[model samples]
Target: MTVLDALPSVEHAAVLDESSKREIRRAILTAIAVPGYQVPFGSREMPVARGWGSGGLQLTLAIVGPDDVVKVYDQGEDGGVNAANLRRLIRRSEGVETTTDPRQATVIQTRHRVPEDELRADQTLVLQVPVPEPLRGVERDMNELRRMHAEGDYSKMWVSLYEDLVRNGVITETTGYPCLVGGRYVIATTPIPRWDVPPLHQAAFLSLFSAGREKRIYAIPPYTDVEPLTFEDVPFEVEKVSARCRCGLVVPDGDLQSYQVEIPQQDGSSVWACSDTDWCTRQRVEAGLLDPSAITETEVDL
Candidate 1:
């Protein structure tokens, strides 16, 4: 059956709160006008905790409609505890349809990892960024940081990287790679894997980033320039897994495959997939893609 057919009916009174919608609409409009600029907004308290995917949840509530199909992922896979919690929150609040198929989704909210495939121009990818500043660590004072960004001063960042090279031989930074957007604005590309970074540069889709605790919103419109910060000798590199997904599945254009693994403990093991739980469950039920019950607590190692 189609995604819409699988979803439950929406209750107009319960779907949206007036204040939240207004705030999001304003933020989105400001994002469109400012392009690479990061705009601050009044983020609301979500049922989910602050560090979780609350930012994405707020955006989903703001943009999702009765007809839109929503898909959420964390760390490339589906059906994890956190992903499932976020899905339950959205489903309870809005009663909208959810899926794992990137091509089938009108909106996608992700954390830490982007899908293994490429997204289209029409779809919107909302990223949950823990930090939004590329120069935050370099300049602790917000006032000074703002001035540096305003004046396009990034010498300190270069100096810092040089220091890292001298001390550690390599940058040593693993997550939250920073990038220069539109050639003028420096922004954090979030904590997504480095493999997902290049696909974001000059992509067809509009990429929106929101940090709830930070109360910041930023965007990279379709075809906008996004370049990673790097020296001429040291080029930017994406992180790659030495092994392919053990599932032996190839992701389609704008889609990804799910894998089940067991995390070992002192006594027993916990078997679960990396994809969002809601996505995996739906896929299993609808397409016979994965068997949830087959995942035992003694077979996988994280």
Candidate 2:
């Protein structure tokens, strides 16, 4: 084939070829068929760097169509640098409509946090995963880890949590809590804080996770079971925040101050304003704090 036929045209940089997308779609279907099972795929390198969400972009490219509306978020904000760049890239390639509103999106690609709004049954969520294996820290070797997964040998994982409970008086596996999926494989959601984990349990929308660097993809279908590992007596608990947002939204307040103190904001304020930029802004408008027309990307800094 000629060079022109081999590579994608600059005009169509956002969308992959039909055959390539079909392969990814097939892999995604297989993953969905077998919930919590990590299916390996031929992860392509995108223009963006590896750590900046190449996997989630690939899934978006494969599933996104001209008619579908997409929303991209990093740490619950779509206006952030990473999310904006990815959204631009996707738009450039597919010429698809994009939105900050979660309710309007057909597909939502997110890193580190799920949207604060309840996702509908028809919506699809693509999660960018840094590490898909829940047993990675416990067993470094891939072969041994696979063997452990096959044998359901998660004793090491359980022991670690038990130790944490013994020392801290609570299971301190806060974010990326190792969860048992479909009562089978143990999979950890990528560093999404504990507050977001509960939404995954029997969620209405289909949740798909892709780790591009790791070359693994997994899915949790709508209505699937996702239970965080914890003893019956010592039940799992989410991180609690002390205060509500000024707009009357239940947001992380004092506890978040500890973690967000290091992040320098554009206005020199702390990053504890709102985790979900769109949600917070909507709440503000609903509360008549700001006019709908005044809402802009820069107004709310996540």
Maximum-lDDT candidate: 2
Q: What's model 2's TM-score?
A: 0.88
107: Cα error in model 1, Å: 0.6
Q: Number of the top candidate by TM-score?
A: 2
By summed lDDT, the worst window of 10 consecutive residues in model 1 runs over 245-254
lDDT digits (tens) for residues 201-239 of candidate 2:
999999999988988899999999999998989878776
Q: Rate the local accuracy (lDDT) of all candidates.
A: 0.72, 0.82
Off by over 4 Å in 1: 1-10, 13-16, 248-302
lDDT of 1 by residue, 211-283 (tens): 8888888888889888878888998865433333324342323255443333456778443343334444445
C-alpha TM-scores of all predictions: 0.79, 0.88
